[model samples]
Target: MLMDKLREGAQGRGAKIVFWLIILSFSLAGVGSYLNRPADTSPAKVNDQPITAQEFDQAYQSERGRMQQQFGESFAELADNPEYVRQMRQAVLDRLINQLAVDQQAREAKIRIGDQQIKDTIRAMPEFQKDGQFNNELYLNLLSQARLDPNSFSESIRNQLLQQTWASSLTGTDFVLPSEVTLIDKLLQQTRDAQLYTVPVAHFQKTVSVTDAELETYYKANSNQFRSQEQVNVNFVELDAAALAANIKVEDRELRDYYEQHIDQYRTAERRQVAHILISDKDAAVAEKQAETVLTQLKGGADFAALAKEFSSDKLSARNGGELDWFERGVMDPEFEKAAFALSKPGELSAVVKSQFGLHIIKLVGVQPEHERPFDEVKADVLAKLKADKARDLFIDQQQKLSELAFENPDSLDVVSESMGLKLQQSGLMTTSTAKAPFDDAKLKQQAFAENLRDTNANSEVITVGEGKAYVLHILEHKPAMVRPLADVKADVEAAVKLQKAQVEAEKQAATLLSKLNNGEDVSALVKELDVKVESKTGISRTGATLVGTLLNELFRMPHPAADKPVRKLVAMPEGDQVILVLNKVTDTDQPSAAKSMLQTQLAQGRMIASQAALLQQARDAATIEYNPLFNSQPVSE
Candidate 1:
């Protein structure tokens, strides 16, 4: 009834957002729970605070992951290149230094973030939300998976906020001029007319040729490209509770016994539908006297609902005839709940009662009595509980045994395999690329091929593949990294050589056409000779999709045509396609209101970024910094 009354008055966004607010309140209730490490060496330091090696590694890994997500396959192609990886590491270190610098300065300024502010920020993150509500469990699980605790996560967030707040505070002088906005809007709305001809790399493949000598030369020069990933065959014993549960058998007697033992689990609690008229005053005696008067009036058959609306102090529920909705035990004040449940029939009125909030005359609206479900009704649940209980106990015992045995007898899993009655599963030789389930994780794959284990035939420590599943494995055989022989990869080699030659030829021909056009000569003859037709496009924006990004950007970068003259250039694309572009005209039109708003937003963002960067650089300029040697320059963490 309380819900019904609230709904009647609830309007628009206010009604919709109430649930979100409730969820927001409890979003971080468990973040501090389940919330450790070696003394790590420093890779760098700022203001005498060590930037530990582990911290650097984690930072680099997080940056690499962001790039991978944003750039996808393009990032992957250069992910293993030494120069690219070094630049990535340097960038990550620079970011860390900047963040640390800001953090130090913020503390000096006495800038602070409240715990509630941090929690509220975390609660509002879309990534932590599911179906429009913050999922506390999901948030905790992500932190766990990221190897972060609440303290570390909160500190990280605090630093970010400090940087943003500090930057915004300093950017008060970073206003953009209307002239600049108009200029930017015009540039953004600029359109180009151009003639385009695509030189497909595949078109020249037939004209290119390669021989065995060339293939051999290329193979030797780039052997690393052809080398096989180091691989291993493993034998493992795994424990999976779900898998184990499938084989567990529970008798009818056991199911019945479990049901009886935990019968409360199947019983629903008694609930009361209650309504009350509260009479509150500064004086307790006066409040009681007023409540007794209301009770007397109710006894005289005055309409309870009408009296409630006129007299109750709980205005929210009073508007609904003092309805408190249906609530189970433990949900209300102990004394109030006791008095409310004592009444046997609907419309039964209780004597004036005094409680924590005020004095009240209560009415028993209805009741939902506590009841246990019949055995047949909950039979499936009882069986499942019994099976799960058995499986869990069995899993815990066997997991302990597996860990102990795997450690004690590191040479083999056969001991644990037999001891735990788990079958030893074997797999075919597999590289990280071809790893099977349970070994697909790069860390697990690394352990499978660890030199210590490979040399001594030792079982790995118990590793969890996921919930309810874990395994200990030992390498049975290993194949060290080796280059593929030319004979074995002849087809791939030929294809690569042909593609390389074709791309070179395509660009060369496109360059010739570009040269002719630049000299103000007709390229129609060359285009005809190449059996290609030029396409004329009008009003192409910066984001034109007909041409590759490289070419389109190049076309827009060309100067505006003067006295009917055209701008010509040759652009090469990453995918090996070449574009011969002739820019005929450049025009700027009045931007729509939406375009103006977008340009304003973009200009503001750019200004903010510039300010933040300048501020950070100033910080870095004044900060004391140091870098230490790294014994090994590791690849960018995937």
Candidate 2:
């Protein structure tokens, strides 16, 4: 319900507000409106705080950027939808509301998260820490790169922790009830031990007699379903890459002049194949200088591989004696690539180059000289470009005729198909779950199987299915709903019945095993009698997709593993059958360092989602939201 509201809000009046506000802000700045205007006029108010037009527009822009990253092409379509913008604004408002609430609560509850605590938390973050250890420089550099000041970032973290403390209090109140556990056990405890029985549907055949009068009656009653929709006949221009290439004409003189002017583009840059070593920044500048001294010795007749094997700090590369694969210009860092490419001959040693990776001494083992192309040699390339240009023009010509003919003449796809030389294909009675045809483009398949298309009746509609090609679809026929004859699906139904029986048998056996265990009978002996293997699991962690196996998602939600609860976890494997785990114990791990490090990522994502929800609720409660009367009056962008 909330998601639906958010979706509606995103597409309604909210989009108009965002668009107009942005335009006005830009226009105001251009004309110096702010200089002559009073500062007190705000767009709206939230919790007694003025929501300035400037602030609202800034928030809208931020939301747009996030939407672009998340939805890409979808965001472009959504941008024109006011309800979508409304929802986005609500999300921003939700965040602000949550932050304010958390700040107030933190103050009231005397929750003081100190700088040292923030430092400890930051150090514990795996992203900032290097090699499983805290490095202050790594922390500073990474935060700065993310455009985040460390103090502000830490303060944000503090606010999150305070909010999480509140959220945990609200949503995570734990309780145990035997009745509830029993019902859960019954629902979840599934097992299979029964033999399957098959009933072949193919063995049964039914003969049906339809009178001519009955056939006529049926056809007349459901004539709309049988009748094909009016198809399209169109002739249009089409533009494509091949047509563009065909139309491009390049003269001999023009090619020669263009080649001369852009000679540098044709000439390949000189390249060097080099191998080098890197040393750790243990003593920062001193270690780098010392490593350079060692590098010089190797360049002056020392074995390059041996020196690398001894001095390189990069373990993976060091094992191969710093033998980095050959790199070209732009592949390596600018300073390193420049130094390497500047070498005139092989086996030449270059001066030390400093990079963020560290200082590197280079040695050239191979050289490739730069070469330029003559204009005459590339004439064929020019001619091919000309043909492609022509093809594009022809395509565009065809497309325009196609759209016009299709739009003008309905119920005549054959005319357009014949003229365009495209074969008409028929689709089977397709549902939304139909598999993509072999010849169908991925985009076409996506459109054909969209939920909207599935519900739509017979109508000739144009859908852009290809990257540049459009399809004028004609829904030809539809099948009416009827209960399938039992003989047709008897085998499938029988197989379903057998699987259900097997599950019943397995559950029955599990109930007996539980009773035996409660009576203090040997659990292992009982399992042996039942001829089932006893599966064991170990070292399950609270964090990560590791150790818990594929069925871990099911287990994590289980209140407790044992306590006679039914936990169906994947049988300790990447891919395996489900094991009905009688949770033996729920153990908490003592990886405080790991937990503290991972806390930021998990808490931040979860809090952001909750904060957005809260913000939307606050905005919805305050505003008299309405859609434009003209909206939904016409078909919108498909």
Candidate 3:
């Protein structure tokens, strides 16, 4: 019931924001909890906790960092859209506010997060530790540098623990009944019998024609789509991990020692290919007796494959003579696994064994014993990993120096380049379209185009692209963003206009066909009259491989058919293809096997997640949340 509400509410933007807010609370686990300093403006406040603007900016930057990686070149395009920025910032703020709510709820419930918990968490953090042990002086020094006192920092750690505990209490407490599991399983695995009437976008595209004026009008109206990409050229210095790895030299003695120490890592586990004839029945006694009878037949020199194919209840493996391909331990039921592994030789059979699935007569078919590859064969991999490890250690030391040098001498990358022996390099004028690595990296690009770097003409702080790789750059040249002239994109504009018209015509034809089909028109007659092609099928699963993605979704979304009438839906695919669906019947699973167990687990988890999300919403409602003038709750028009 809770899951149904969540799925239904998921269509709303508010519910999605709330769902993601729950996720973000856990993701930003150790962020600064609360700041008490009096400020001109507060971004938001949850109950008694005042959220500082700096915290909001930090969260926003983290969000941007994630988006920068995922969207790549397109992320920069998002900046031009003000609404995206507003929503992103609001989301971050909401997450922070939700976190405070979680903390409050945990305290109200008498959850005690002691100082020892905070101390343990802080000690475990790599930033505050050296050589895997907590260094009090280092921790204090780093906190002092950040201008965060030890006391306040420890408080933040306490909050993180409370939030963690609170999140833990929310899950692992919900469950599903057997009936609920069966119903959900049936719904999920249900198949449909349907017929498809497709009107190809290509057919309409060939029939449609657009005027030059229409093309020009579209180009002018959607100028943003044809805007020139923003870009920057920079003079930079980089400490690359691959370069460092190449320069390092290792002794043969060290290589031999390392190989010997970690030799077990290269060893492969033993695997067995076995066949079993399963005797699955609700009555355990019946199943065990049947399995014993099969075992007796095998002992009497009956062919194993023939008996398995005839008697095995597991239909999937039975067809292949009950052959289950090579498997290692930990994948099968404990009793079944132990029984299967106990067979010492090929063609050896196990006595009837009881498992979760019922009773099984097991046979050992083939074996591949555990073995390690020769050192010569694995030398290349060993060397690569060793190089990576050495480079990572070197990078940590060098990265700190790089950041210090760039900041202390901000005028140019020359200082860091000369000090670290890295060559000072210059990038060609690269637009968002033409940007290539290492400059093409999100952090590097963001730094290259940052207002402060451009305004000050100073070297950027060390920007890390990946593990053991960092760069410091200063912008040398900039290109202001502009839309391309209509003449330059004339061909693209013409294609767009034609496709738009063609899509409209295709949708019209598809909708008309759908109306006719639902109103009792025969599909065979409409195929000739509407110039569309029809394909029919039965028992199409949700994961139907032959069905187009959009049409498949629409097929299941439609209500079940009544009597002779079928459920009808028209789908307009993004790429201009149109499909009219006629869903004739819904066939649900009659007797579920392991699927019921799987759904029970999944439904239990879903119920917990839904409960957690609902609680977060309730917390937000109960708390006093105030946003400054910078934030507006009203929707932003695109």
Candidate 4:
């Protein structure tokens, strides 16, 4: 179903399927019947094509560019981190392999996409539309905008659909057992009654006074807890991009002249209030002459917009008085723009204009003269330039002093610190798990903990922080990986002990409640008698998420209900408390509806796990998947 729906966006009046088939044929033909070529290049082959380094680089760069908008300067992180790079490369390779497999299958099936279908699919894409309907000129412009060849773009969409279909075929199934259905219904049950109870832990809290001696003892035992990591107190020069932008200047006279010379760039191109009466199946020559006749009528004093409203087949613009809004040159077909722009005067009508869309009569309305930018309009831009220029000057001066202090007296970081009046700021202990500093750009953070930067003392590393600003960091200290001290964890130990006790107590309570329920005692009555809480949930679907604090999953996994024994289940809660749930009743419901809902959720989770497992196996199966020996493969860098 997902594969079928993937075509929905591209189905241009039911023609995309045929179109995609044609595209796939061409792509397959390029492989020249070598779909199963040996995996020789780097031990993995895709669609009979050798997995060349260049191909890898191309995919890598494409992914890199897509990520650039999010990563900015930190795009280097992928390249610097060997594991990250390898993972990304493997993903690309996996996708390529899957694509090849799908293409091979499509080729075998002999699916052929027609020319008309391809055209229709292209027309349906919003990116290639002029206004709402397809225009060939607009389509070409869109391809140019994305720097993609028309055929290549179409082929990409085709391959994506092919892969979707293959993936669905491999994983989608409708062979669910009735037992599975019954099990799901029982799992979905949420029979929540009422929960009422007091936590006795709060009562004990008031009497648990920690003495000064106890606090002292705790502090002494945990003194290693307060013992901070070796943090680098860095002496550095700071530069702000905004400060640079503030001092840069752009002259007003220059702005005014630049605007005047390029006034056409700002000019509002003329638009036509045109309409057409299309004879859809008419001969091209006959339609051309007939359209001329309609143009002649408008020239002979017929109202252009009025005639458009009455007879134009272009319903969208026809209903709006046929007023085509101002569009720039190259936006419309050349023939249409030529005829429309040729009618220079208001109320003047042009001869019938021929385009890919057919023929159209054009009328000129009021002309909107172009306006040039005045010096005053761009004065702020000039001021911004002035600010940036000044900031650059100031930054360069400060950088020179910093460089001299650091390089000349390389023995100590103090020379730069004392002379520049720079405050030595220490960082909190940072690890791969720590959240990145907000002020530190992604590139800076990457470089700070980079393997190349590690163990290098007092070495200055510069990282770009966008807007031409950069950060220069000096590593003063480095700590290798080491075990955490047990003495430094007294508070943690106490908390763990408390939670362990609570869990034991909760388990005892749960077992007691279960025993009473097993002996024919009402669960609600037993809960009330023991002063324990009773929670019930109702009408929960089998596919629905587990409710908080419930043993729903364990309850669902239990053996089916029978006369001999009742289904009992237990689960540990987040707070270390335990829960016991028993399926009180079971019932059957509509299978199709339930199956659809259940499979949707089940299939999603199943697919993710399957995809991951499949990809891992595929990678492992590929021969000699070796890493560069220079890369440290250890989990933790020392």
> Which regions of candidate 1 fall more than 4 Å away from where they truly are?
1-166, 245-393, 403-421, 452-454, 457-461, 474-477, 519-525, 591-593, 623-638
Among all windows of 10 consecutive residues in model 2, the one with the lowest summed lDDT is: 194-203
TM-score of candidate 3 against the unseen true structure: 0.51
Per-residue lDDT for 414-461 in model 4, tens only? 666678666545455565445255335566665555555445555464
Candidate achieving higher TM-score, 2 or 3 = 3
Q: List where candidate 3 sits over 4 angstroms from the true fold.
A: 1-105, 111-174, 227-429, 442-488, 515-531, 543-546, 624-638
lDDT of 3 by residue, 393-423 (tens): 9888889989999999988877788888999
Each model's Cα RMSD: 20.3, 18.0, 21.0, 17.5
Tell me which of candidates 1 and 2 scores higher on TM-score: 1
Worst 10 residues of 3 by lDDT: 30-39
TM-score of each: 0.59, 0.38, 0.51, 0.59
lDDT of 2 by residue, 1-638 (tens): 99998788878887879978999989989789757664454444444555444444444555566666677544555665778765666676555554554556545666666553455566668977667765556677766644456656677788777666654554454343444444334333322111111111111112123344544454455445443332222222222344344446666676566567667656666555677777667578787787778866975789877877887766666687666555446446678778888776766777777765677777777876677776677666655544554555655666676676666656556676777666666665554334334214444444444445335532244544333455655445444445444445444444444444444444555556656544667767646554555545554444444434444555555555445543433232322122454455654422234234344445555666676566435534654433223222322222
| Candidates ranked, most accurate by TM-score first | 4, 1, 3, 2
Q: What is the lDDT of residue 184 in candidate 2?
A: 37
In candidate 2 the C-alpha lDDT for residue 634 amounts to 22
lDDT of each: 0.81, 0.54, 0.80, 0.57
Best by lDDT: 1
Write the residue-wise lDDT of candidate 1 on 1-638 in tens digits: 99987777675587669967878766655443423232236778898988877778777777766786677534644664777887778888888988998888877878777654576688779988888766666687877766577778878998898877877778866777888888777787788889888777777887799988989888888788888888789998879999889999999999999999999888877778999998889998888778888898899999998999999988888899999767666546667878898899999998877776788788999999899999999999999989999998888877888899999998877888888888999878998788877677545666787898877778888876545888898889999999988888888888888999899889889888777778888877777767565799998888558666777778878988897788777777788878878898888877554678777778888988988889899888889998766513543345
Question: What's the lDDT for candidate 1?
Answer: 0.81
